[model samples]
Target: MTSADGKGPVVVKEGSDALLPCSLSTEENIEGKLFHWKKDGQKEVFLYDAGVHYNNGRPGQDEQFKGRVSHFQDGLKHRNASITIRNTKLADRGNYTCDFPRLQNQTFHIELDVGAAAEPSVTILDQIKDWALLQCLVRGASPMPKVEWKDSSGNMVPAHEPQVSQRGDGTYDVTLQAAVNKTDRFRCVVTQEEIYHQIYAETNVLLPPPPEND
Candidate 1:
């Protein structure tokens, strides 16, 4: 119903179906009413009129949404107007609005965050003394995610500033560095706050063997 943050957007896995919830708490019958759904600046994501789904509405529905949008019609009496978008894509990452014009404050909105981030990985960029210099990478996630490091104890580990860049595909690549002591097992975690989507990778960092002396 809600994410851990409560304020974060609803996170959904890439290529997976996503639901944008909207319900009128009061008695609202939308049988023939113009119940509309849309993303900002985009064509109608879905429309209900004359007891028919207008996902194929004229004026050209966005091709990306064809045949993948649906609503809960059975709950019309209960005012359940939730919609599901199947096989969601990165482009679906944004705010959505669903509303009933006949009622005041009937506009319900939600955000969809999609995560297709490749497997997270850690590389030993360098090492010094008891600290093993580590580099963590989170590749290709939409809405851009924040990366953090944690120790085996689940405590937040100290990490240097992270370097994040956007790829041509509109996803993001994030790299961060941490110094893990020999006794530490560190994990690199990436999270998309809007949807609260997260993925993590772990690595055991051991102190490098002492330099050989001739």
Candidate 2:
């Protein structure tokens, strides 16, 4: 799909194949055209043109990207020279450019983050003797994220003590406090709609009671 803005870098998950969309405003016959894909400072990793794969005919692709690279068929229709990299690896993280032979040059840069998916944690702590403190934590998220608290009924519970704070490491920590009740089920929802495409992670926690000995 087209990017939200006309220009910028796109971020994708590691280990998963990503499609970088590129559209040209110029009208030209891209059929039987030569398409080349390569990293910014690297040689051509894959090439296709004249309805055939040229990388195999030429010097061949790099040993690292032997069978992991392919051109997007539909991309040629709208002047989209996107490439699909299968089984993406951490080393594949870098900028990419698509060169159209005898047509035009287009560059699309991407950043791939390879690591474990974010893990969300919910903690219930008692504060002010009667208020229940619900904390939601997510690690390794860029651009921050939106946090919300909801009850079992799927209704948004009003929270007066909700705070969003940034950790020293640049991660995010959200805290929402509400009156504690034995029957209330509080859920901490962490969403990064833009990057993750949905709620990255969430957790449900129950408020515990004070110690009887106290």
Candidate 3:
């Protein structure tokens, strides 16, 4: 990857879209030319032949990117050759090279990093004497997120370590149990360390109803 100008790698969430940066110089007064985007020793990320995008089992194209790649036509006139990758995959992580035929210094090399899921579903499990057991679970994440319990004051709560399990699809499934005092609002936060992404689910301990005045 180029990594030039302190352009760090782009982090994209899985199952979402990603943009690969590239452009040609309009100062060159070029009419139209071929552009190519390919993965390192893997396959062609995208192929533009004389302003036409080729696919449908066309040569020099990879199946992984066949229906997922598209360009911004209006930007093309402004020397923009960037492509968008829809529904990103974990396998999409790596280097991507964008080049224009016969154009000098018109290549953009970028590295893509796929982030994991960070939303956890939380619920009140059981209410015991003075406290309740809260359960939180998040699935379909890579590298397993850190599941934790926090109070409304932003203080970490003492909770059991989450039970982490790997799914058949190569993702992770995690469950954490926490005990919370009634009348307190608690949050279950799941953090993906790779991208420093954090998402949380909130729940509250229900206080007992007041007695009726007779």
Candidate 4:
């Protein structure tokens, strides 16, 4: 069993698909070698020899992995045994191991983090008697996050002045302002893609008077 090279941690979002790639450096024929992929510390999910089968030599696979996993025979010829996981879930977070019978085994660790779809937070930038400026900050995301504002009635509330800033840490900072009296319930929704997964984070911004004004 030969280990894969340059394998590192992979982050994925919820409800998405991801591929765990692995390759061997050996020149031996992989067809005769028994192949197995399992979630480390979990049950074997996939195995193959001259044909695809499970650990028990059954014709079918574990129901939990039905329609969610697959591998390529040609890929294995090149010492590649990458597996695809469709509709990734938060529960799928963990290390995965690929082993070859009478050979070496390779391990790949995966970390999956689920982002919140609704996170409501507020930061008062400035406040006046009739008007105020507030900042709604949404953090920890991949790809690009979409931020939208909504009023209490669930109506789309256009930002009086919309401003967006990218943080050094790869997250986003979105700021929007509204009239103090017009404030009711403003919701901030953040959406992004982590790896091949879709994740989101959101926060609600409320406009209340400062302690001095209260």
The candidate that achieves the highest lDDT relative to the unseen native structure:
3
Those runs of model 2 whose alpha carbons end farther than 4 Å from true positions after fitting are: 1-15, 22-33, 41-45, 49-66, 73-80, 87-94, 101-117, 127-129, 157-182, 200-214
lDDT of 1 by residue, 14-75 (tens): 88889787776566676666677888646678877657666544444567788888888787
Candidate 1 total steric clashes: 1
lDDT, candidate 1, at 120: 78
The model with the greatest TM-score is 3
Per residue, candidate 2 scores C-alpha lDDT tens digits across 1-214 of 2241345555555567765554455744454777667765585667777667744466667777777776667657766556677776646655666666567455444443332234566676554553566666665544466666677776675665656676565445555554544447666566665457335333444445756994
Residue pairs in candidate 2 whose N, alpha carbon or C atoms collide under 3 angstroms: none
Decide which is better by lDDT, 1 or 4. 1
lDDT of 2: 0.58
Name the lDDT value of residue 116 in candidate 4.
25
lDDT of 3 by residue, 1-214 (tens): 5532237787778888988877654544222777788887467888776656765345666888878898877776676777899999888888888877576646667888776676689999899767789999898787578888999998998998779889876679999998876578899988887766788999879867546899
Per-candidate TM vs. native?
A: 0.68, 0.59, 0.69, 0.54
Q: How high a TM-score does candidate 3 get?
A: 0.69
Worst 10 residues of 2 by lDDT: 108-117
- What is residue 36's positional error in candidate 2, in angstroms? 2.1
Candidate 4, which segments miss by more than 4 Å at Cα? 1-7, 54-60, 104-128, 131-214
The 10-residue segment with the lowest total lDDT in model 1? 1-10
Off by over 4 Å in 3: 1-6, 24-31, 55-60, 104-107, 123-133, 142-146, 152-155, 160-175, 181-185, 191-198, 202-214
